[model samples]
Target: MIRILFFILIVLALGAGFAWLADRPGELSLIWQGQRIEMSLMVAATLLASLISAILIVVWLVRVVWLSPHSISRYFRARKRDRGYQALSTGLIAAGAGDSALARKMTARTHGLLSADQEPLIHLLEAQTALIEGKYDDARKKFELMADDPETRELGLRGLYLEAKRLGANEAARQYAERAADKAPHLPWATLAALDYRSQTGQWDEAIRLLDQSRAAHVIDRKEADRKKAVLLTARAAEKLESDPKGARDDAQAALKLSETLVPAGLIAAKALFREDNLRKAASILEKLWKHEPHPEVARVYVRARSGDSAIDRLKRANKLEALKPNNVVSLATVAESALEARELQLARAKAEAAARIQPSEGIFLLLADIEEADTGDDGRIRHWMNQALKSPRDPAWTADGVTAPEWLPVSPVSGKLDAFEWKMPVAQIAGPVEDGNVDMADEAIRSLPPVAIAHHRDEPVQKPVEKVVETPVKATAPVKVEEIVEQPAVKTIAVPVPTESVIVPETVKTETKPAPAKTEEPVVEPFFGRPPDDPGVRNDSAKPLEKTTFRLF
Candidate 1:
């Protein structure tokens, strides 16, 4: 626009000058080379302007002709470069789409047209094509080539890491991930892989440092960073708790500052404080954790915070915990166990029953059995409760990846995941529900097994206990004393009706009378009950197996 306006201005100025010259005409006479030339001013001006314009035009034409070769060469080069880029783009798309043939074709075309130094995508396309074609060696070579280049180092490392994982080479994968993360902490995959490996190897300090790098690079959010840091600090605290109490306490306390409700952090902090003889601080921490989330470890540590304290004092502490978290199963169980330790059988039984009413589990039933043993010393009642416990649902424990741990762990042993352990029910058998009155699951379970011979000692007294025998669907803990299989002895045979399915339906299956194949000369094995486990003839495996052979008493 500016050029056009300037050109117009110049033209208008010349026209105005011409008009002025025409209005006030003058003569121009030049004496040169012994010759005299005369002309009007307007005509001389026109001829001079035309000669300068013609000279400029001739120069422009000569310059164009002189540079034609270079110009043509540059045009073709640019066109070839564009085609290479087009092929590179198409190859990348084809590789991602799993079109190995097109990807390979385009990769070759792009490689022919473009140098890998100038276009990094060419190597990437080739590597991807090799991977898609199941040529692992070629892909790995290409990835190595990429990794050697400074510009494509991260991409190459990612490819190498994936390939290592595919080949189940964890150490190689870890090295690649760590190398990539060290060079560029902002890369998400590299950072996460590096963190996981560091945690798995128990490199707590290094892991924390790497996590900080990730946080600083904004690869992880503030909330996630805080949580992960808390877990790491808690794990480190647990490691140092025994050897360096004060140091563990500091680390745990710091973790608590980040996540106040972390149970493991609070537990470690309290224990470490206790080890340091900071009873007041430890007790305070335990109370705070209990109020937030009731945990068994917290209760146990709090109840026995002072080693010098008597059982009654521990019971008092347990009472305080129960008061803080009213009606909770953990709190009630803690109180009951403490009371039992203090010899307060009544209180213990009452608390145990109350907890059972709230939520019956193996732990709760076992606590009840403990109370019974403490109170009456009755073998019958204790076994009854023990059987109930065995029949109860499984209790919750620290489980991760289908594996249970006796204590909390920072990472899963199975999957190497962070913060994986949880206090939840492990996968176990589901027992039958308990019945009211005289229907004891333990005795019933024993009776459900195959009949075992009960040989009596001379001094023993026997009594017949009537029971409707039925097979249990689940296996019993009762021991089946097996006699070695031998030659069949002559014995009477009785027809026993059994259902086609797992259940024994006496009324459904027709009972047919069959004649005895042999004479009743040999003694028959008759199933019996009504004797305590201490009976000389009854060799019971479970300490709590029901009367004699586990039959309900009539």
Candidate 2:
């Protein structure tokens, strides 16, 4: 728009100047050696203007003629360059689409049209074609060649890093990533790879520094940076705990400050404080952590902080911890354990049972077994609890990458990921009971066992005996089998031994009675010695009289 306006103004100025020249008429005469020439001033002015315009046009025509060959060459070159770029773009698209044949074809065409040095993208396309064709060695050579070029240096480094990773060359990958990060810290992949390499190699300080650089460069956000810093600091603290407690404590505390819910950091800091004989400080840290999320390690550390205290005193401390997170499994289990140690059987039983009811887990059932054993010396109740424990779901542990650990670790041993361990149940698949043809025999054996009462030590009402009657008719020629079955919900049947020719004991209700033929062998009654009836105790070779005793089921 401005150009058009300027042209219009110039034309208007020329027209006005011509009009002014015409209005003031003047005459001019030119004298030559042999002739005198005279003309009107307006006519001479117009002829001089026409002569200048013709000279300018001729000069422009000569300039164009002189530059024509160069212009033709440039035009062909530009057309070829455009075709090369188009081929390169199509090849890149084909490579992404996994069309190896098309990508290779386009790559060859692009390479034929454009010089390798003229287009940096041609090298990338060639490398991608090689990669698609599984020509890794050729790809590596191209990328290495690109690394020498200033413009493609970062791209080359990234390619090299990925190839190194694919080849499992850890050192080479780390070198490439570090170089890339140093050159361009703003690159997210390079920075993150460099950070991971440092972290995996136990270079905690370097990892933390790299994380800070990434954050400053805006490669990572503030929240992610803070989380990574906490993990690294916690790992460093764990490493220095035994060697330098003071430094470890400082790092752990710093990590905890950054992320309060960090279990490993809290544990490490509390342990460091404990090592320094700062028990109160350690307890304070653990208590603060327990309020957020009750961790078993924190409770253990808290208990350890007061190691010299009596069981009752420890129980009080455990109660204080439990009060912070009342419904937490860790809190309940810890309190139950402390109560058991303090001889507070009722409280222990209540807490353990509550935990089991809330989340039926192996740990809770085991705790209940401990309570039962401490409260009552009855083997029946303890065995019952133990059986429940065998069927209960497993408790949560520090799990990372499908590996579970008894203690928490900041980094995964398998993947070397920060904050990889989680407080959750391990993956488990419960198999159903095997279906075999011998199920009936097993059922029959289970039905033969006598009921053993599960004794409760608490001051609750005793459970009434549950009697189930099963009738079996006897033929004189065929032997009669009387099997006793004990049934419990969600529990497998227990069997009592019965003789093949045993007589059935009648229940209180009236039933048809069948007289049994006299048997030559006396009946034997199996004794309940807390062993399965099928387990033969000892063989007596010497002949002895078979003792007969009346068996009754109530």
Candidate 3:
């Protein structure tokens, strides 16, 4: 509508100009060179009209000759470029879908129809399709060719890495991944692979540095970096703990400072302190950790800190811990160990009984057996504990990985920490051997025990009180049974033959040489499971030097 209006305006202006020109006149000119000339108005007007029309026709002819062919060729070229891009897009989709046949067909068509520079992506798509089709040779050739292009170099390398991994050439894959990481550290997969390779080779420092680099590159979360650093620090601490325990302790402490709730660091730090005999420090660390997150191993050490208590006391504490966090294996195991530490044979056995009832663990029974062996020198108890351990159901969570059977361990078995009280058995000197007619087979018993139950004497008495009681808990249940509780004064001699039983008969007896009328106590009775006591003051009939047990007070 605007074009029509514009045409009408142009026509009206032309008509008005024509009418004014016709009405006014035309020009007549006389040359001044030599002569004069005259012309009519109609003739000059017609001449001017012919000149303007000829100039317009010449301009239109020039435009048609110079511009139209080039425009037409450009339009066709653009259409072809569009079709090439279309084929390239289809080939890429086909490659992604693992349709090698369609990709190959499109690749050939694209190459034939388009220039190399115009269809760079076709080669990448073809190589990927070859790889998906398991044509590694073809894929390698195509990828190597594409590698010459800087834009596709990393892509080619990544494809090669995948091929290497598929072929199970881990070293080759690692090399490629390292190159990729070096070239582009921000690429997450390459960075992770490089770190994994380093970690597998035990290059912890290098791995840690790489992790730091990844963090700086914003490739990993800060929290994850801290966690990985903590893990590495723990490994370093473990390595140094043996040769340089102080250094190990420092490293562990540093790790804990970085991540206060990390269990491994707490464990390692506690162990390092304990190795240095810094029991108070170790106990303090564990106590703090237990308040936040209770672990079984920590509980075991905590129970051990409360040393010198009978097994019952330790168990009371452990049971309280269990009440707080039920079915705690570490606390239960420690309670079992506490009995051995206190040399409370009955208490240790009772802890084992309670632990076995709470959860089926062999460690508890082993602990009971160790205590029995140490207190009474009983081999039968060791066998009994071993049998109980064997019969007990296995606890997958309590048992360490790869162990088929859990072994019994002694409490405070560390050298210089073992309980070393000596039993006071004494005898009179013999003069001569007479006849063969007296061996009291009904009374005495002796047996060798496992070395785990044996305690070595400390060269020096502890000046400071050992922090053996890490925890003290009040009892909520009924009191422990005291039928097994017997009081016997320290004995000095024995005049009976050894029996095969496990119990230490009479529990205790005072020396016969001491004053007798101080207290005429009733004969002590053994608990239900214990070996019955022999007759008091029974004379031995043995004449073969009367091999009586004896002790000399220190």
Candidate 4:
């Protein structure tokens, strides 16, 4: 619109100029190339305008002729570049699809058409394809060729690392991962691979260092870094345990401090302490741990540590523990055994009963048997405890201390109960004579037995009325009264001993009573419930046969 208006205005102005010039008879003159030229003003203006138009036309003709070839060439070059890019794109797709042969052909065509500087992506694609085909050697070559290209360097290193992993070259793989990590620490795959490599090689310290690097680089979250650090620290602790248990203990403790919920660290620390003969510390650790995790092994260790106490006493302590954790079978068993060991027979029995109520199993019966046997040595008492075991559900998890069943043979068939068929004494008789004449020897033998077995064994009486001292779980010394002396200004008196009313002396010196050789009776070993007689007639390898054995009664 502006161009049309300007053209109309120029035409009007020119008409007006011509009318004015024609009306005034105007003329102008100019000198050029030493020649004088004269003309009217309108004629001069027209002549100058005509000269400028001719010069513009000649310049237009020369420019059109001169620039046409270059323009045509540029259009063809652009088309060629576009076609090259198309080939590169197709090759990349094919490479991603694992069509190595097609990708390789397209890659070659792309390379032939595209400039080296423009086709780094194609090289990367070709390298990836080679890696897919398990051609690590070729892949490595391609990646190396493109290593200088900043855009592809990290990717190439990742591909190289993957190729190294495929070839089982862990060291080489680690090297590539490290390089990639240096170049692009935020790359998740590279960081993860590097972390894994460090872990697998037992480079915990290095792994931890790199994890910090990853965190600083914003490659992983803080929580994730802490978790990874924990895992590495645990592995390091395990490694340290073999060479330096104390160091291992520190590491395990550190790990636990970092995450209290970590069970492995606690367990490792406990085991390390136990190995160092720090049973007290181990028990403390276990008790603390039991509050969180009710593990059977932890219970076993805790019970073993409190060997001085009866199963009943242990049961009471365990009961207190149960206040923190209710109906915990492992804790219940620990306490039951402790109570029996402490000679708190009733408490042991109650705890065992509670355990049975919660979960009837061989363990509960075992606890019961421990309490009964601790107070009475009667074969009948032992058998009664065995009966309880037999009646209770068989727990395959229970093994008689060190006794192991045949590997190939199945465990006892008494499901959810003790192995009823295996008994050492008669179960039918609940109470009977607990001891024979040889009480001293029997006491010595009982003392020699393991704490658990002794706690469960029935107490036997000595023929000589031997006075046995029962120890309280906790001991207290009687307070002694001290006589205080004051200065001369105050009168102080010391307490005097009270005089006995009478004194008696025996005519003869008392001596230990000689025990008679009581009749040795064989205990009856019951198959399912009661103990049958030990078969003396049948020859056996070690222990007495079941039929002739006279059962001890408690």
Candidate 5:
């Protein structure tokens, strides 16, 4: 709007000036080549303006005529470049779509139209096509060539790293990743790969440095960086514990400071402190750890912190630990074990029972058995507890990837993952119950024993007991006769002879009545609980036969 106004004002000023000149009617005179001429001022002014306009038109025409060929050449070049770019774009799309044929064709056309030096994307497209065709060698060469160019160096390194990983070249992959990380520290993949390489190779200090770099670059969060650093520090401590206890102690302390919940770090630091005779410090660390979560190793170490301490002292220490984390299975078990060692049978039995109630496990049951044996020297109670121990749920251990370990480890041996081990129950395989027939046979064996035989096997005298008899089903073909003999106190004993050719069915005694051919009668062997009377648990190779035996209560 302002330009329009200014143009109107300029035209008005020119008109007013022309009108004023006309009204004034001034005369103009000029002498050219000794000839004198006179004309109106307005005519000379108009003629001057016309001549300037004509000069500008001629100059513009001459310039256009001279530069026409170059303009035409540039237009054609631009058209070709546009076509090449179009092919490249299409090829990239096709490559992403997994169309190898179209991508290959577009790659060839793009190469023909655009110079590789001028169009870097053309090289990328070609490499992608080679990858699509499974031409790894060609792809590798293309990426290597790209790596030489500063503009694509990081991208090239990433590509080469992936290829190296695909081909299982660990060293090559690490080199590429390190190069990429050097070029661009913020690249998450490169930083992570370098970090993993350093960690896997036990270059923990280097790994920690890379982790810091990653955190600075915002590739990893502060929490994650701290966690990874803790893991690395703990691992380093474990590595150096045997050789350099001081250094290991420092590392472990640092790790525990970062993450107190880390069991390995706590254990390692406690161990290092103990080795240095800093018993109070080690106990302090373990007590703090026990407040969060109770661990058996921590309890053991805490109890053993002062090696000169007696069993009663250890028991007091364990009680202190249990007080920190009340009702925990580890705390209870530790207390129970300690009490048993201290000959505090009542306390041990109570703690063991409490531990079993909290988490029914084999360890707790075994501890209970120990308590029972120590408190009451009865074989029956001991055997009962042992059987219960065998049937109890398995105890928690350091488990990783389905593998259980008796001791804690910083990493999983199977997967090589840091802090992989966890204190938990191992996965148990599912098994179906025993067959009904087997269960019935076992039940029948227990029932078939005479009352006198049962009483004779017991270590204690029997009180007045009620007796129940279970009838066995017999086959019609084989019938056996039972002879009864009356005994004192309204007791009676019955004995049944076995048929020669009959199989014993414990649940339902069935016999075949069919008699074999009258041949020399061999001594009949009755099946006692599905075995011969004299058969030991193991099979014997020696053969002895023809001894007939009668059933007796003893």
Candidate 6:
């Protein structure tokens, strides 16, 4: 638009000049050596414009003729290159679509038209075709070629890493992952692969350094970095505790600073401090850890922090921890164990039973059995609790990645994952759903148990508690006939055993049977579902009160 407007303005200016010249005409004259030429100013300007236009046209024609060969060759080359690119695109599509035949065909065609040097991705297409055809050797070779080139180094490393992982060559995979991560830490697969290998190999310091690098590169967030670092520090501390307690303590303290609720870190730190004879610091660390997340190990370590403390002193310390985290099953169990060690059987029984009521498990039941044996030496009661322990769900242990460890660990044994162990019931230990109301029922059943009159040493006589007069429940329907109520004399029959045969013995009844019609109903007798009346196995109740009868051992 500007060009057109400027052209219009120039034409107008020329017309105005011509008009001005027409009004005062003048001729421009040119003189050569042998000839003279003359023309008007307007005529000379018109001729000059015509000559410049003709010159431009002639120069355009000459340049076109001169470059025609090169232009033709360039046009054909562009067409060939376009066809190769089209084939490459089709081959990539087919590879993604899993059409190995078409991909290979296009790959060959592309190779015919273009070399790997001309298009780097042709090598990738060949690799894809080889992979789809199950020619892993060829694919690996192609990847190696790509890896040797600077342009496709990261791509080649990624391919090599994945292929190595697939082939189960963990060392080669780690090498490739480290190479990729060293070049670009932003790659998640590379960073994770390198970190996993480092952790699995127990290179704690290097693993920590790698984590720092990854955090700085923003490949991993701050929270994840701190968590991984804490695990690494804890593992390192555990390894160093025996050799260098000072260094181990520092590492564990750092780990605790990173994650306050990490129980293993707290335990390690406390143990290191114990080795250093820093009893106060060790106890303080354990107590803090217990408050955050109460663990039985923490309680045990805390109670036994002092080297030469008596069982009584340990029991007191256990109680203090229980005060910090009261009513917890772990705390209660720890205290019960310490009390048992101190020979305080009653205290142990109370705490253990309380813990069982809260969360009944094999460990608590076993502890109860131990208390029973210690307190009264009651074999029946002890066997009852021992059987219960065998039947009850197993207690919580340090489980990680489906493998249960006897103790806490910073990393999983199965997957090498950090911070994996948890203090919870193992999956295999779960029986089924347990009613929460069972605790109340169990308490009632235990209370109803008759006190055992165990004999003491030196032939001391044991005193038994007074028996109560208990009423037996009667479940029956009354007769519909409206007859006068009459009491029928009925004798309770008890089965008596004999060496040869069994017989029924009559016993006196204190509680009256429910009233029925005067003459239609038979005398009410206790129903017995035993062997035939003459069976030798039949035993008599001997008219003993329910309280005096040792009915069930458990």
Residues 1-554 of candidate 5 have per-residue lDDT tens digits of 99999999988997898898888887899999999999999998888878988999999999999999999999999999999999999999999999999999999999888898998888799899999999999999999988999988887898899999899888999899999988899998888788877777889989889888889889988887788789899999999999999999999999987887888898899899889988788888888888887878888888878879999999998988888888788998998999999999889988877666555666776776677666654443455556556655577788989999988765577755656788877866232123444334324423332222222322344344434455454443544554333222134433443454544332212121112123446643222323235323333437453243333321
Better of 2 and 5 by lDDT: 2
Can you write out model 1's per-residue Cα lDDT over 1-554, one digit (the tens) per residue?
Answer: 99999999999999998899899889999999999999999999899989999999999999999999999999998999999999999999999999999998998899888888898878889899999999999999999999999999999999999999999899999999999998998998898889889999999999999999899999999998898899999999989988898889999999999999888999999988887788999899989999998999999989988889999999999999999999898899999999999989889988887777666778887887777666655444556666667667788889999999999999999878888898988975544323332234433433442222323322354443322435443222332232222212222122233334444311122121111223468754333333455444434455543422222211
When sorted by lDDT, best at the front, the candidate numbers are 1, 6, 2, 5, 4, 3
Query: lDDT of each prediction vs. the true structure?
Result: 0.79, 0.77, 0.61, 0.63, 0.76, 0.78
Task: Encode model 2's per-residue lDDT on 1-554: one tens digit a residue.
Answer: 99999999988987897888899998788989978888888788789889998999999999999999999999999999999889889999999888999998998899888888888988898899899889999999999988889999999999999999999898999999999999899999998888888888889989998899899888998988898899999989989999999999999999988888888898899888888888888888888888887777778778757568999888988999888888776888899999999999889987876666555667777787778777764444566666666766677788999999978776788876667889987866353122332233223322443233334554454543333444453433543343433221112222233455554434332121111223549643433334346433434557464443333232
Model 3 C-alpha lDDT per residue in residues 1-554, reported as the tens digit of each score:
99999999998987887788788886787678788777867667767888998999999999978999998998998998888878888888888887889888888777866787766677787787787788889988877777667877777778778878888888988998898898888888788778767765667678778889999999988886776667667667777878998988998898787678766677779888877889789867877777676666677766655446666676666655555554455555555565566565566566555555555445555666676656654443456566655644443332212222222111112211111111111122131111121111101111122232223222322232122211223232333222221223333322222233322222234443222222337643221222325424322346344334433211
Q: Estimate each model's TM-score.
A: 0.68, 0.74, 0.53, 0.49, 0.64, 0.69
Which ten contiguous residues of candidate 3 have the minimum total lDDT? Answer: 437-446
After superposition, the stretches of candidate 4 with alpha carbons farther than 4 Å from their true spots are 1-68, 131-136, 147-150, 234-254, 267-293, 296-317, 333-554
> Per-residue alpha-carbon lDDT of model 4 for 18-53, expressed as tens digits?
788788786576799999888888777678778998
Candidate 6 per-residue lDDT over residues 300-333, each given as its tens digit: 7788788699998999999898899898888999
Ranking by TM-score, best first?
Answer: 2, 6, 1, 5, 3, 4
- Record all residue pairs in model 5 with backbone atoms less than 3 Å apart, i.e. clashing: 477-512, 477-513, 478-512, 478-513
* Segments in model 5 whose C-alpha atoms lie over 4 Å from true places: 1-65, 361-554
Instruction: Estimate the Cα RMSD of every predicted model relative to the unseen true structure.
Output: 14.6, 12.0, 21.1, 22.4, 12.9, 12.9
Residue 394, model 4: lDDT of: 52
Candidate 5: residue 23 lDDT (0-100): 88
State candidate 1's TM-score.
Answer: 0.68
Return the lDDT, model 3, position 279.
79
**Cα-lDDT of candidate 4:** 0.63
Error of 2 at 46 (Å): 6.5
RMSD of 3: 21.1
